[model samples]
Target chain A: MNRTLALVLYGIGLALISHFAIVFAAPYLATDVVIARIDKVRALTPNELRVAPPTSPPRDLVPMGNADTITASSWLDLRQGPLLFEAPLPRRGEYWSVSIFAHDSDTDFIMSDRDVQAGEPARVLIYGPGQVPPIQSDAIIARVSTERAFLLVRAIMRDRNDNADVEALSAELRQATLRPAP
Target chain B: MGKVFRWVATTVVALALGAGSAAALINFGGAFDARIVNGAWETGRHTGSASADPYSRARGAIYGLWGLPPSEVVYYTALQDDTGQPLQRSCSYQVSGGALPARWWSVTLYRDYFLIENPARRYSWSSTTIDVAPAGNWRIDVNAAGEGDNALPMGERDGVFALSLRLYQPLPQVLDNRATIELPAIHRGACQGSSS
Candidate 1:
């Protein structure tokens, strides 16, 4: 091949690689920034749930977070082993949900209040890639692709003024626990 | 040695060009993406889902991390008004619509993806907080001065902004017919001279 043609081809190849690398790394970098910020404020630890008050204006912990919902989250590190995630459900006819997001920003699993009996607690066996499921449990089975994932719970506060009810509900959610699978 | 230097120079330039273009697209491209467009609002078909494309997933991380898929929630964003003008913080607008096809819904204004700071401490209005007409229609005023009962305060800042419509537990019809759903129309009202 001609010298000029070879150089052009090499440049094009490098450019394409650069472009795809940015596209692929964006999610992981974004997730890392988010987790770091959340940790800074909440001092988050693995498997320990922390509930946030309604998103205050001017600055919200998360972008586009609803001001009318009480939210709680727990950082999950499943590299060591499977985790048992338990969540408490609110009354029927209320809007509430628990979702798990993988490191790549995909929704690994999501369950709404309607999925379980009203006001019943939810249990799930969360395992990462190559991890084994627990021997026995009625909990829903969920698996994520990455060892680093997170669980988010959102419950509507119909009346932002009367937040006592929602506060209590979020407290109940905080009671939900995560621990190494037995 | 001369030929090696030329190759190195060309490769460096190519890498810079590629990285710069990628950054620009990720930052300036439509935040919610354009997989589906209904009127002026748009959404990503697989946002926050495993099936999402790379661009969609990247955009979701910046604009809506931890967002649910369309089955649980649908998010539509409008960066411009009905007239194709950018939504400015210096202007007043009227958002009018009837009942939406969802169990619950809300409209919130954001600047750079964060809720605009206002004295009312109110960043959004939802189905539960809005005053519905006897006919089930509702109108929210995006007032610059933060006036009116059903108003989203634009604060005193001056710049472009976005309006996000989130429908939680959207009805099956909405997911099936995303392109035909009737979203609220934003009509530009008045604007501060030379600022909008």
Candidate 2:
């Protein structure tokens, strides 16, 4: 090939490689800040829900978080075993939701208060790709594609003055357990 | 030696340009499947899901939409007015709509993905807090001076801003048929100047 053609081919090859590199690395780099924040909160215990410190104007690890609700999150390593996650159903006239995201940031599954039967707590059994629960019960079974994932919980508050109530709800959610399934 | 040096420089520049442009397009390009509503607002059809493309995933990460799915929460954003002009902070506008199908919803203002700092410290209004007219319609004023009971204070920032409307627990139809959803209308009002 001529000198100019060889140079053009070399540049095109480099551009393609760089584009793919960025595509593969984007999720990890973009989610690093949030992962770090979740790590700080989850350092005390693994697979346990960590209630983020309440901040005025709502300092969320995620951008554009809902100012109307208090959020709690947990990082799950399902390789250890299946995890049993549960949360109390919201009171009447209130709204709440539990969303599980894969390591790649895809939302694997979501459960809302409306999904739960009347007066029943929200419960789900999350397992890795190869693992299966011993028995199927009333709890929702969610199979994640990746061994590592994130669980974000949100509960609405009436207003800013309702921080006390939000705190109470957060405390209730802190009691949400992530334990090995029987 | 000169030939080797020139080839290295060309390769480096090409790689940098390619990677930077790819990342920028994924994060900023309006190429995803966003259904337009009311001639102003746009909502992503598959924001946080396995079906989302790489660009959508990158955009979702930048937007800090961690775990929630479209079924649980549908987000609608408007960076322009009904006339397709940029939403400037200096210009006042009115957002009016009827009750949405979601169990709860809110409209929030953000500047470059962060909440705008205002003296009132208010960032959003939910279904429970927003006032409704007798005819079941509601109106919110977007003003820098913080006018009206339902005013979303724009603060002193200039340039373009964004309005994000979150519909939590929307009805099945709203998710299945987003193009026909009855979203709020954004009508531009008076523009004082570029400063606000």
Candidate 3:
């Protein structure tokens, strides 16, 4: 091939490869930024829940957040071992959910208020990839492919003006914990 | 030696151009394409799932991380009003709707991907927060100052904004038929100045 034609073809091939590589890597890269930001801002150790304060100029890591909801987050480090997830549920009419995301931003599992019994708290056991759970346990068991995952707890408020209710709920969500599995 | 130097330069330029173009496309082209269009709102079927295509996953990570799968919560975002005009912070809009087919739902306004700051500190209205009018209808005012009984603040910033409608535990009808689902209609009202 001529010199100019050969260079053009080489450039085209290299460009296509570069484009695909970036696109494939973007999700993992973006998710890493979020996990790092939350860790830095919250100064949280793995499995410790911190209910994000609903202040103006919201301080949460992600955008398009629901300010009306009291959200608590924890970085689940399954490298240590399987962890037990526990949280209080809201009333029947109110809304609440626990969403677990993989390192690549995939929704590994989500257990909402509707899943649990009306008055019972959520009890879930999360293990890492290829890890096994107890053969007999009341807690809902799930497995994630990544060693590090994210757990989000959402508690929706019925009335925005209810300050006392908000604070009380925030306190309860802050009590949501993840401990080493028994 | 001259030919070798020219080849190296071409390779570097080609890689740079490719990477830069990819970044621009993902950043500029928002997450949802034409997959599921409910009026102005749009959503993808595999959003927040591992099965999502590379483009969808990349865009979702930047636009909305920690989003639940559609089986748990279907998220719909609107960048424009029903009239095809981009939603701007300078304009007031009336978001009117009736009961949605979901156990719980919320409509929130986000400017530049974050909740707009305002004195009221109000940013959204959900199924429980909104007061039902006669015939189960409700209306929310999305304005700059973020005032009113049902107000979704867009803050004082001058720029375009987007609305996120989240339906958690959607009814079978909504999940089975997303394209024809009835979501709130965003009707643009008065504009503050020359800004459209």
Note the clash tally of each candidate. 0, 0, 0
- Selected candidate, larger TM-score, 1 vs 3: 1
Candidates ranked by DockQ: 1, 3, 2
Among incorrect, acceptable, medium and high, the docking class of model 3 is: medium
Where does candidate 3 chain A have its weakest 10-residue lDDT segment?
A53-62
DockQ of 1: 0.70
| Model 2 bad stretches (over 4 Å) | A2-4, A38-45, A53-55, B28-38, B194-196
Over B63-162, each residue of candidate 3 has an lDDT whose tens digit, in order, gives 8888888887899999999998999877889999999999889898888888776776677888888878989999999888776659887776676599
For A82-107, candidate 2 gives per-residue lDDT tens digits of 88887777562267778887777777
TM-score of 1: 0.93
Q: Which lDDT tens digits does candidate 1 get at residues A76-166?
A: 9888798887777755224888889999888999998888876578887889999877666688888888999988888887766566776
| lDDT at residue A127 of model 1 (Cα atoms) | 92
Q: What is the C-alpha lDDT of each candidate?
A: 0.82, 0.76, 0.82
What is candidate 1's lDDT per residue for B1-196, written digit by digit as tens? 9998989999998899788877776665434544788887877788778777677777788778889999999999898888889888777899989999899998988877788887777788899888999999998899777787688887776666888998999998998788888899998888878644
Task: Identify the superior model by DockQ, candidate 1 or candidate 2.
Answer: 1
DockQ of candidate model 2 = 0.60
